[model samples]
Target chain A: MMQEIRQQTDANAVHRDLTRLPLDTPAQQAEFDAALQANLPREAAVRRQYGMDRRTFLKLMGASLAVAGFGASCTARPPEEKIIPYVQVPEVMVPGRPLFFASTMVLGGVATGVVIETHQGRPTRLDGNAEHPASLGGSSPYLQGAILELYNPERSTTVRRNGAPASWDDFRAELAGLSSANNANIRILTETVTSPTLAAQLVALVEMFPNARLVQYDPVGRDNVRAGGSWLLIRKSTPITVLTKPKSSFPWMRISSLVCRVACATRGTLWPATPCAKMQTRPA
Target chain B: MNQLFRPAANTIARLSLLASLLAGVVILALLLVNDQSPYTRASVGIAIEQPVRFSHKLHSDQLNIECLYCHATAEQSSYGGIPDTHTCMSCHSQIATYSTLLEPVRTSYATGERLVWEKVHDLAEHVYFNHSIHVQAGFACETCHGRVDQMVVAWQAQNMTMDWCLECHWEPEEYIRPVEEVYTFGYEAPEDQVELGMQLVAFHEIDVDRLDSCSICHR
Candidate 1:
């Protein structure tokens, strides 16, 4: 290998004219002849004196064959990748790129706006939506980890009743049967629901059954504070403490101000009696 | 008689061994050369088989549809974004409704299953490339993607190596085009290309030093 490399380097230096050399002297010619002789077929006498035995030769052949076989087997042929195009491609997607959709994920009864990065149509990543009010370009750990949950293989894929597999249709049919039966003992048990649609549905179900009752229970919930807030409204008029911090991370724009308004409406009086409250009430 | 045959057999054995060694070396060299060649890469200059035989040449070159019409997020997001099935159905539904070639497309639409497209010019996972930043920098899509509008199958024309990216990053004035012509497929250089590009670079306030930083692409 070394000799071959040296010859190749010399050949390249000589502009690839391999037919003749500029050997000017007999001594130089002799040196060239010796170098050429070194590459010629060796005599049997030299082989008998110093060459490896048949055992060594066989061992070498076995090693070389094993190495070559292993190398050949190790090289993974890249799979024949296919590009499956959309039969009816959506207006928002392109062929070779990822698309982001602005959506919301419910965490602890509050909806946090998130932007999901979809490769083809499968959600692969999640980030907070910069434009959304709940999440201003920042996501909680739960929202960030939602993509993993979306792709989790262990996630339940079917509805079940009594630990037996049942489809969504079966569940719906059961719900229909219960509603039609209209039993006087019918009761609805649920966790605190901030969603207006779900709350309305529960209210309508109770109204449908004259003797039916609806109960809200949560192990870790904010409903207690909300219930206390309602009681406070009915009882003695509590002093509205307007806590305004000058250094605010969130912008006091339409979104944050609306949040403040909801806080005031639920827990305390909306009217600002203090001077600081009046000063901080400017719509920014 | 036995001694005479033994020498002859030994000579033949030695010759065969030498021949096998030489053959192995030659085969190994050929394999190495073949592996390094562009033809073996399978990504460049070869037509990638897609589910639906979509043609960019027909849409962009013949029909004159803008690149951004389908890749709507190119200028706004990090990704250029592949169009959804509904986008193709908007046109293909009427034209190729009964064609057997569009069977996959129709099947996907009916079943609501997304077609998984194999990316032709995928970068290393560690490298982060933002298409919006490049578009905002006034670099034409063809500058990196090559003449995709002219291709029927859209094979990767360039190697897309880090070295190749660095070549333009070192001298971005030569690559920068006007923002209006960013989507142009095969833009020709004007007589004063260098001067115009330099002026545009200045006008756009593109920080050349910032572009050359490792964090710019690697992050």
Candidate 2:
């Protein structure tokens, strides 16, 4: 008998934190509300009456102050604001409406499809594209934070070599010189690439230089299942395993399996209510 | 005579206080009223300057080109994308390539840079407005944007406040039109507009409750 277990540890995947208080019932909500109310300032009765907390009331007050300050400044004799109209307006762009473009965000060689919201010409926000298979309308944190990265003031605007500014033409000319040297002692190192087109390009580059070599280094390493398969042959041992029956047939058994802890059930499976409490391992 | 004068003085003081209170109320009301006035609404009537002196009046009214020819994304995406430089060169390459006015366009095309057009009807950062949903819901381009077809220099027509958006969302029947008539400028509502609007709302499956939620526009 042999057993192979597949485990998913994609850090980008959504995981519910077990340490957080679970508010699954109305009782929990009422308890939380009570706790919040107990800590509220005594002077915030007026805010509470309007269904607002002290924090929200303070925020509103701050916003009012900011607005008043802004309004006072605006009333002063400032330079006249100019309105620049287009000489030839594109038919598609409305003067004031935001536009969305379908784009992809890559993290660790995996691409997640996202929709980029552009105001004027700058990308302002990123939302998961529902049409894309990888995202399914939910975005990872990387995709959500991409807009800040786009607007980051400290991001590189030009190519650099050894902390000095460089240009693409200069780099290309340098590469051409090296290629003409016929130096067979070339080594190209890259992170794990999943795209076939990129792989093909790397292969072509290696072929162009007869002695050139390409090496892929992945920080996360390869799948453990493949590693396990090879180890089983080396040891020549059989691993005993037990598979849980359908939840309808054996509900208790299904609930006890550790796999049931994280894997959502698609058919006749009940979600473990108590987190780790339901992880029951049985002898095969 | 002294006691009588004291009462008179008290009455005068009371009357003056009341008069001043009324005056303050009037002044505040005037300020509030002035906020939405056409003169106070920035860029409402003023012609905005552009890199190119493009006239909507000439292209839309004179040339008879459809609004969608340039704003192709409005029907499918949240934005009506500004046309690329090629879109300009498509016509101006042969029409007015040598004109001083077309110099910027030529330079942008030659250098592969974009002409940054000044935005006219920009909304606040908090509000989430989708152009496609309105267009798909049978709203004419002029419904919120006013008449761009006649604008020599495009200007803001609507106040574009939360109250203005809520007023329409609460009573969308007045604004709802046929999908085909959505692009039609100066579209008039039918005589039984309220009843027709009710039917259209139901047909379109527009959840009135959902539309009125804070999250609908805020996030």
Candidates in order, TM-scores: namely: 0.56, 0.54
Per-residue error (Å), model 2, residue B114: 0.8
- Candidate 2 runs further than 4 Å off: A1-160, A167-284, B1-41
The segments of candidate 1 whose C-alpha lies over 4 angstroms from its true place after superposition are A1-159, A164-172, A175-187, A193-215, A221-242, A245-284, B1-42, B55-65, B69-72, B83-86, B89-103, B106-117, B180-186
Give the C-alpha miss distance for residue B124 in model 1, angstroms: 1.9
Residues A43-158 of candidate 2 have per-residue lDDT tens digits of 23654578765456788999999679656744632234433435445556555666789987754455667889886577888877878755555555456777898879777788
C-alpha lDDT values of all predictions: 0.69, 0.68
Considering the two chains of model 2, state its CAPRI-style docking category.
Answer: incorrect
lDDT of 2 by residue, B104-126 (tens): 88988887666777877766668
Tens-digit lDDT string for candidate 1 (A1-284)? 99999998875654333114324478855654454444432422343566553445788999999788757744523445544445455667654467899988765455667889997698988887888655555655566678899989777788877778899999888878777777756767776576899999988878878778888776655555556666879763323334343336444533345443433332212222222343444554
Find the 10 residues in a row with the least total lDDT in model 2 chain A.
Answer: A265-274
RMSD of candidate 1 to the true fold? Answer: 16.6
